[model samples]
Every structure is written in structure tokens, then in C-alpha cells.
Target: MEPDEVDFAHTDAADRKRREKATELARFAWDRAISGAELLELPDDRLRKLARAAGANPPSTRETWTVVADLLDQKSAWAAANPDHPQASPAHADEKIMWVKRPIPPWT
Candidate 1:
């Protein structure tokens, strides 16, 4: 294989693992939010502690969970209010997430 291809292949597993971990953490945070425990209400230190308790290894900070909680809350609230909506659940919208990515500035 070419050098670039080999490099990408090696990195692919790590990337996938990272994505999985992020999603898992997000899910945990989402559940907590839905249960009336808003993840964003915690400070960064508290979030990291909670994430560790939730099995996130190194633990994501509140800032990271804040973003996840926000998106999850939006989806959750909408789904609760509009039970008949086509895209009403995370399971139904997982594939659609890819299409929502916007180009980020290089600095970001």
C-alpha cells in the first residue's frame, strides 16, 4: 500500500474508537439531561467527574458535554413535543447527522 494509505489505515481504528467514545459519552449525558439532570449545569470539574463516573475513561469536561447535551436536548424536547414527527428520535436521525456537518474554520 502507498504511504498515505498505510498511515490512514493505522489511524482509522483510533479515529473510530474516539468517535465511539464521544458518542457514548454524549448518550450518557443525553440520558441524564432527559432525566432532568442538565449536564450543562455542572462546572467543568464536576462534568469531568461525572463523565468518569459514567465510564468515559479520561472523562469529558463540562464544555464538551455541554455541546452534546445541547444538541441532545434539542432533539429530545422536539421529539417529546412532536411524537408524530418523522425524525423523532436519535436512532432515526443518526444517519442524518453526517449531512449536518458544516465546514469549520481552520482555526477552530
Candidate 2:
């Protein structure tokens, strides 16, 4: 079977909206991450997953924040796209956004 590029397997409107929100949040967080902006690092991944949920082809996860900014900048032209969601609007831009980062133990 061919891939569902148009819908990507999602059909429900609610699911589509949820996915859109997730992507918006991800881009917002990505902008902040590469900009050296301070964000409220959530105490857990439960909430952080919202921002990274729609990442089908996210930047390499093996690297640390040290080189993520440089890599992301070159990988794609990710402008600080303003989100339509109220929470991500310019008014709340200063508010501490709850973002998540991978929580893998160093020892493997």
C-alpha cells in the first residue's frame, strides 16, 4: 500500500486539530531552544510530549543542545512562526512555556 501523504493516516477532525496544535507548539519551542531563550522546563515529559508529538522527521535526537541549534538552523528554515493558539500568542510569549526535553540517563 502507498503512504497516505495527504492525511498521514489521521481522519478525525479532533485528531487533526490536536496534531496541528502539537506542531505549532513544537515550532514555538524549537524557536525558543535555538534562540537561547529561557523556557519553563517541565518537571516531567507528560506535558512536554505535546510540543514534540507531531515530529515525524525531527532533527537528530542523538545530539545534545550544544549543537542542536546549529544543526536545526541549517536543516530547515524555521522562522519563529507565530501560533494561532491563544497560549502561544504574542501576549503569552513572555510567560514560561512548559516544554519537554529528552530525559535519558547518561549511563547506558
Candidate 3:
């Protein structure tokens, strides 16, 4: 669909609201990623707020899973570019992953 036609997917006011909220949350996540915060650091309440902004109930497990997956992608990219940088959480040991950006698919 053309760029303008994308709005058609959420023609209803409620649907539009939900989309906007979700987009905001995603943007916030990206901002935090840029600032060197772990995606999991985002509290559930914040995610719920984003869901509310989208005019829907707070995100479900599936949505959270998607968020985490995207975060891992970011972390991987960061690691490749900055191998010398310290991990996000050395104490946790599990937080040693880097951040990476998802490549824009040519299809877009």
C-alpha cells in the first residue's frame, strides 16, 4: 500500500489511537536503546501506559515478546560496532549483550 494508504488500516478513531500509542512506546524503546539502556529495563507499567496510549489494554505476553526480540536485535548490532565497550550489566553477567539496529528490509 502507498504511504498514505497506511492510515486506512486504522481508519477508526480508536484504532488510530492504539496505533499512535504503540508507535510512541516503540519510539521510546528506541530512544532508550540509543542511550545504552537495556530494553528489559523498561518496566511493565511503562509498557502498559503505551498500550493505554494506543487505546487498548496493556500489552499482552506476545507484545512483550516482540519487544524483547527487537531489543536483542539492537543489542547485537551495538556489540558488533563497539566490541570494546563494556557490557550493559557486568554484574548480572546475563546483560553482556550489545545493541544493534534492525536493517531496513528492501521490501519497505
Candidate 4:
């Protein structure tokens, strides 16, 4: 009945779609990136450094997947909102991707 309420009602579906698409796309790219690498159980601080290069700013307390997932979420959300922009693969789509992390030391 109220204008603000009506507006919210209309946008609720779009919001859900955006979030779903964002999560889906982000996970797909992350999955691809780690598909072949050996799984290392490193501390959150060390792992976040790698995710940071990929463009996510997750806190130092999150797990590796959570860190990367946050990155993917951000990228996909951006892509979905700006559909005209390059949607190829946000993780691999940017110019800053030239960043390469140093190799992870072997587990002790």
C-alpha cells in the first residue's frame, strides 16, 4: 500500500536474482582456479594474501574458500549489475590479474 513498501516489493525479486547470480558465477571461477592445485591447509592470514590478489578483501579470519568466495561474489555482483560490461569471467577478466602469488611453502 505504501510507496516505499511497494518499491521494496518490486525490487525483492531482482535482489534475490542478483545475489544468486553473483554467488553462482563467483563459485564457478573460484572452482576453476583451484581445480588443479594441491590443497594446502594454510593459516587464514597466508591464504587471504592469495585471495587478495584475485580482488577480494575478506577478513584475515576466514577460510580459503570463504576468502575466494567473497572475491567471486563481488565480481559477479558487479557483472550482474553492469550487464553491458565484460562478463566473460570477472576473476580472469581484469587487467590487474597479472598479479601472481609466491608459491606456498611445503607443509611442515
* Pairs that collide, model 1: none
Q: What CA RMSD would candidate 1 show?
A: 12.6
Candidate 3 per-residue lDDT, tens place, 1-108, comes to 786565543367755554454555544444344322444454567556544643566655544435444654665577678877766323333322233334468974
* Candidate 1 wrongly placed segments (more than 4 Å): 1-10, 34-42, 59-108
Look at candidate 2 and give me any clashing residue pairs. none
Model 3: lDDT equals 0.49
Comparing 1 and 4 on TM-score, the stronger one: 1
Q: CA lDDT of each candidate? A: 0.54, 0.39, 0.49, 0.46
What is the alpha-carbon lDDT for the whole of candidate 4? 0.46
Q: What is the C-alpha RMSD of each candidate to the true structure, in Å?
A: 12.6, 11.0, 12.9, 11.1
- TM-scores, all models, native as reference: 0.43, 0.27, 0.30, 0.27
What digit string (tens of lDDT, one per residue) describes model 4 on residues 1-108?
Answer: 775565542377855644554344345444444321222334456445544543555433333354345665555566568878645243542432333244789999
Candidate 3: pairs in clash: 18-54, 74-99, 74-100, 75-98, 75-99, 75-100, 77-100, 78-99, 78-100
As a TM-score, model 1 comes out at: 0.43
Looking at model 1, how many pairs of residues clash? 0
Which candidate leads the pack in TM-score? 1
Model 2, span 44-66: residue lDDT tens: 24334433553533322222222
Number of the top-ranking candidate, with lDDT as the measure: 1
Write the candidate numbers in order of decreasing TM-score.
Answer: 1, 3, 4, 2
Look at candidate 2 and tell me the lDDT of residue 56. 34
